[model samples]
Target: MQVKTFSGASSQEVLAQIKAELGADAVILSNRTYRKNGELCHEIMAGVERPAQQGGAGMPVSAGAAPAPSSGAGWSEWHKDWMRVKEQLFMLMKPAIRMERLTPRQRVALEYLQREGVSDGVSIALYNMLAARPGASVLESLAGIVPIRSWGAAAWPQRVHLFAGPYGNGKTTAALRCALRLRKEKPEMQIAFINTDCLRGNGRLTLRHWAELSDFGYLEAADAESMRKALALTAEADAVFIDTPGMTPERNLAQWQHEMGIDEQPHATHLVMCPFYDGVQMQALLHRYAADGDTSLVWTKLDEAVCYGALVNVAHEARLPISAISYGPELKQSLSPATEPMIWRLIFKRQLPIQSGE
Candidate 1:
């Protein structure tokens, strides 16, 4: 038995990271929630034990396996009680193990069940309610509850590429990288980079560097008319990428749409994702971003993460075709179009390798 440890803000995050490193068939041994470094964290300890070739019991015995000293007559009854509890937990978690589709929150609930020795009936009742409601968190559903999935370029439409996400998700940097990539790929093609993030100094500096290096057109839009006029001019160019500030769920998305003039010829919306995020939170975050139609996913910092479970959930639920994925901070050349087989290898194990152009 090989044991591994992981820590994350949520169980979904931890599991996603683990799956990315260990693969889907890895067995979980134990999981628990604990406070760490001033934040609530989930600590999961898992084991990756190979299964037996033939159909046989594969449970690993404890190293110091020995009968415990107990009341002489009561040992048998105690053992039966423990076995019953274990059976209940196994039953409760079996559904999740077999489920082909599970939300991040649902995934967390299943983990909790596996850890807490919950009954099968309890797990079912909770899961069913969540299935019916469809909006509650996974934890909420399991407590009887619980809650809670980018970008592509091809023949740009002289239209601006809008980058919007929560703060620190790396929007401005990506915009610059994309610009450089476009310049390298088609030097003759006219390209422009627009920045709407006037409030951030980093945004301005990044755009400035792009302007100097690529000799590509750069525009700034402080007002709707300016943005509209800029769009009108850029519409003549081969492609225009618009970089917008990271907005929150609290702001009126409609107002932002109106201000950014997104209502007119909507540009490709790319949802930038950090690999460090847990599965459940990632789904919730994607949902918020996807509220606006025509949104695709751009997975960022793959070089920094081990698990890709969030990627799996995003692919499954949103049914959003992943256009490109980025591994690092290099210019747009660091990003590549995500293919089905690449995604498969990232998720399920035992994937039969298929030849490209097949």
Candidate 2:
């Protein structure tokens, strides 16, 4: 007997074809239903009495592959196991289904983010969550995902405030601005400046100039011993602001930190950056600097940045809150407390807040 296979959308359709080809003497060797690329198909294998040569199974019994015979009682056991696997595959693929439901605007927004150097995983995750929310606009969906902490969320902790970041990231400027803001918020508060960035050509002189003008106490520490001496002066002030050299390597930065006696001192460390936000290295920067919620993110020199996606991407990846933002060179007007709307304006619109006149 030769074995032949038939397939159709339903069993009756396939059975009719089987009867016409093999007559009533045909025996159904196997039958099963399954989904192929999300479409359901039914297949049947039948045996007919005929003198057949070996390997004649290559003949097109029907469209697609000819079904082979089952080992024992047919495909009952095989089908059961297959169905279980199919269900599990369907479950795991549900997220892909959700991805297919993204709106055109959301897709456009995703593309925009990716083009602006946002990581693929972060972009996909944000869009998937947005797609799941019905009636949610892209701007509205994005407004919820980007993390920002208002500058004023927590009052200036009466502790040593330290700023750390790579060179030219505006660490000194940020530390000075933070101190000035704190002083402005509380007029009677006494603030002192400690500069650990002894290597930079003009960092100490620049900070000292400002310190002399403001008449706030100032100390320059070149090594661990100097750092200790500078920190001791913090005892006489309401709050001490610590600024480290941006030129130092990561290991040296850690060494300076260790020598500075932060473990023994009540201190708040802020990771400063000039919005160099993009890619795996950017994420690594966040990981290396912004260790936890306690370590605030300080973004400096927004006036020089044309794209803010890096900041949003870093914030999303690190799950770190932006504590402050510096907009320009002027100390009085440049620094502002970070806020959701401010970050949203920069992110979605790619536009900073309009100055009063322009």
Candidate 3:
């Protein structure tokens, strides 16, 4: 793991520097504006965590350690403070439907969801659930309405994991993160990479670079025949990641499968997305990318998203399960298996989950 602080003129410049220095797997700890040399500049703290280069026991290792996860007490206090601010903000506005006996906090919380891009009906459902169960309100609201499916290493039923999503949605980065995490946990296990995204030259180079660094086999395939040969050749590996180019449902799913020579055995597709996408865009993407029940949702760019309700709302409405989430440009601690509390925090809290922990 390596950590560094970079100063630049703007947010984009700092992020580019982080990505360039730490690669896509780096995680951002903090970003702020400060005066450097009597000039206004932005500072960013970023880090990278990789599997131990010369280790056998699979010990967790990182170059830059981030702040510990917020304790339960601290999280509660932050929620309470946000509630107060929200109540004050809404006090100036009139309620569309006045319901007696509703607490100000409850009303404000409802508005918060609306602002987070939830539909009116879905927001009302969440409000009613929270109102009925004041204790552990967020947990109760999500448990009954949405599913947080687990995709930890133990959940991999197939040897071939397929990553597919819209271009620029972070599929390549997600693949690297997942691959490294798996290797870290199971050092003795055999791993390999099979890239089907042949059209993207830069993406192919990035995957190959990681392969060279990690000392794993990397292969590329363009069509069904080549993919079939790649799989047959890597049959000895325990797990293989198959990365594809941007796929949309508007295209022929069957034809695409045929072109890739995809088989039912030992294969599963995961749709990767950024949580900042609005409801309409998400629905369109899901309709095209995740039409099958087997496809699970993996969110990226959690730090960039101002709110996460729309992502959850789309999943709930479509009956899709959220399998994982990635928070920043840094690959270290960028992705994690999804959980109920995680969804709750992403919806209500401004801070991103800062670590990859239990």
Candidate 4:
């Protein structure tokens, strides 16, 4: 890995420099703000993995020799090692967690969270936050890790939106719910639905039915050329929602988008997921659906989940804000723009985000 330090007047400026020099794959090792020469400055240490034989385009010299492993494989191995090390470190630090400083209620809450399947890292962070401030509640400490950026025009100003996730995760439903919510809020806004899941009969029919009934424009795109024409047709609309197909284990969302020419547009991709998956499955799904640029998490099937600990774990791991959440079997009135109160209530009380008389 090649590491370098960048300093600038602002963190955004320093980050831009890092991305420009190290490419988008660069990871920030550390960042700090300090005063230099009577002026406030931001400094960050960023590192990027060195490419293997840059000019060779990852190809082996000899035709008979085996091809080198890809960078993704290398990173996967590194991530596994890092997770093992983190678990070991957390075990070592477990004894040092000063639980005595917390109130009885706070301690009970933390213990409950542990039983609910929250990760060790999040527990330690909550412990530190509560111990550092005597008056801080467990919910407040959790809010620091689980950020909420509600879904709407205000939160997501991008004209193009894409929904992606694993099979049976409710990607199509979430996209439709979001569009309906946006339409309810602004009746004059022009909305369009572009269905890319041509292989799925149910999803395609659902999207087409809702689009036509609601008087919203709809199009289907199964390839790069079709996707281009679909986008061009919806260019005049105020908001364009693209419903993507569920990804298989062998496929990657970022690479697929790049191949389909969807990456060329300014858009936000919401990763719609259910909270019932185990830790390993959730992590695998996150890795498979990972993409560049604007992205957020949209947790679905909240009504079916027993324990919501995976939500906190995913939020902590991905560091992406929660945009919306969907529950119940019905699409209408089942989704809600994620809020801190709603999430905390669901996590701590097992309460659904259902409105009165719903």
Candidate 5:
């Protein structure tokens, strides 16, 4: 495994630098802000591959290095501490272990168990899994446990494209990519790009950019009145690609539902997701987006990821049909619809290659 250190003025800048050079597969080892000279600067250490083991297994164990025998009182105290931890885990898991909804942490622990081939003692296994994957939370880990359903047929051509997800998850770019692809296939499809992202940046740009290049009709809406107008305009058009605002729907599904005017009819709604995020975070993001009932998924940043576990997990959990995949910033050619075989290859058929630092 190769470990690399990068220094920059800020954490975000340093993260971008490392990702650009080492790609997104690099695991972050540690990040800290340090005083360099007189200025506060960021320092990040990342690595590829797992850490080396402490010693070879061939060496015999040394009994002389073992800890001295503990007194009776000390032994009792240690045993009590172990029992307390055990009880806490049980209490924490008691409600949801069988509850239909799985939290991200529990989901990750389950995935860890699957990966490690551990068959029993879920509580202990979960603890050990958390220990190995620090910063991984129950909510984030469980997002992968989304259920599956048979999306027997797609209702695409008849409907406009609806894009939604957490902030900065790339909803706009994905929508534009879809618009571009549609333009190639049906030049006179009467498509309109609707910008529901009233906030700064994000989906607004993707819609605005595509509208500029292709002369596609553009609409902006914030409240129910505007959205109603946009929907009416879309009624006459062949397709309406709606770019929604990026919001984290953790505690308030109302905000998303209200903002999107959830009552309005949409041809298709796709949850745009980035591959670079951690497993637990990804799950939490998915859960929040999947709140709109049967929304589909569109995975972005494929060229930037290594592990395909999250992709598999999201598909299984949300039971959302995968609409499309956007590889890069390219227009028409960069987009492709999601397929079952494509997913199978990512997990079972392909051996991810190691990328050397550029």
Candidate 6:
């Protein structure tokens, strides 16, 4: 990998420079903002895979060309070695899971968490915590890993919020519900909606209808230039909620955001998801939507899920705080700001956030 650092007056400027030098396949490693010479500036570190050499001539291979015959075998061997190491580690840890050391209640709770789909790694961590601190409860241990950051003006002070997720994950509805909640809490706040999921007629219409009915500003942007224009027009609004399209197999969130100019601004991106997806699918979605900016998780369709194990797994894996959750079929009154009590109820008690009036 070829890594480099870039700094400029704005994130957009630095991002443009990185792309110009490293092309579209660059991966952002880190980014920060600081005052340089009495002026605010953004710095970004990015890396890209170096092109493979061909024919011993040091010539770079084209992206679409076939790789050397040995490349597939090399990758297969590497994967096998990795799996063996993981298996060995798990084998070593299995002997330490002494269920008899815990009280009957703790044992049952730990067993239940395992049945609910919590991974072995997290269960082991919880076991260690309980064994070290006999006074701590299972809920306390879980809370340390699964954090909650309630969604509102106080928790999220950013003016622009972007909602992105897989197809049929209810990103549009979540965005609308957030806007409604904001309007109810702060009636004087000027809110706007920016739609980038133009490929779906139903979602686009729904966003436009709600924005018009609520008397909030609304615009549609299909690409970077239009998005720039839309942002410029909504610059006066107190808050802007952007609804993004679901990522296709050919597209990536980071690259798409960079191309649309969304990464250039200071904003928050919420990854909307559902709890019904299996662990493998959830991991794939998380990997696909990973971003280097302020991002949080928004779970939807809690009312339809049979097991909430994916929730714990995702929180432990992504380390992103839960921002909000949605249940039921209604757009209004179905979404709630995530809190520890609410999350624990859903995971341990099979209770939805809206059920407890959270």
Best by lDDT: 4
Write one digit per residue (lDDT tens) for candidate 5, span 1-358: 5789999976657766765765443446676777978999978787643326422212221111112112223433333333333343234334334422444655554555446322223333344445456656643333233222212133465466667777766677777777777777777777787887777764467568768878788988887888888888767777777777766433334355565575456455678887666534554465455445456777777766655556654565345666666665566566666555454454443322111111
160-201 in candidate 2: lDDT tens per residue? 777888777888888888878877877787789888777777
Off by over 4 Å in 3: 1-106, 127-138, 248-255, 291-293, 355-358
Q: Write the per-residue lDDT of candidate 4 for residues 69-88, one digit (tens) a residue.
A: 34344545645434543443
List the candidate 6 regions with Cα displacement exceeding 4 Å. Answer: 1-88
Instruction: Report the lDDT of model 4 for residue 352.
Output: 82
Q: Using lDDT as the measure, name the better of candidate 4 and candidate 6.
A: 4
Specify the poorest-scoring 10-residue window by lDDT in model 3: 61-70
Q: How many steric overlaps are in each model, in order?
A: 21, 0, 8, 0, 14, 0
Off by over 4 Å in 4: 1-70, 74-82, 355-358
Tell me how far the alpha carbon of residue 58 in candidate 3 is from the true structure, in angstroms, after superposition. 57
Give, for candidate 4, the lowest lDDT window spanning 10 residues. 58-67
Give candidate 5's root-mean-square deviation (CA, Å). 20.2
Please write out the lDDT profile of model 1 over residues 1-358, one tens digit for every residue.
5679988887667766666765443456677777877889977776554536423233333211112312234434434433443443344345454433456766665555534333343445455566666556653443212111123345334355666666677766666666666666667778887777778887688777867677878888876878888888788777777777666545434457666677666666766766666433554455446535565666666656555545544544454556555665666456655655555454333121232221
Estimated TM-score per prediction? 0.54, 0.66, 0.66, 0.77, 0.54, 0.76
Winner on TM-score between 4 and 5 is 4
Predicted model with the maximum TM-score: 4
lDDT of 3 by residue, 159-247 (tens): 88888888998999898888887888788778889988888889999999988788778999988778888989999998898888886
What residue runs in model 1 are displaced by over 4 Å at the alpha carbon?
1-158, 252-254, 291-293, 348-358
Which runs in model 2 stand beyond 4 Å of their true positions?
Answer: 1-100, 103-111, 137-144, 153-155, 247-255, 290-293, 354-358
CA error at residue 147 for candidate 4, angstroms: 0.3
How displaced is residue 154 in candidate 3, in Å? Answer: 1.4
Among residues 3 or more apart in sequence or in different chains, the pairs in candidate 3 whose N, CA or C atoms overlap within 3 Å are 1-63, 25-330, 25-331, 25-332, 26-330, 26-331, 27-330, 249-288
Q: What is the lDDT of candidate 1?
A: 0.57
Model 4's alpha-carbon lDDT is: 0.81
| Candidate 6 or 2, higher lDDT | 6
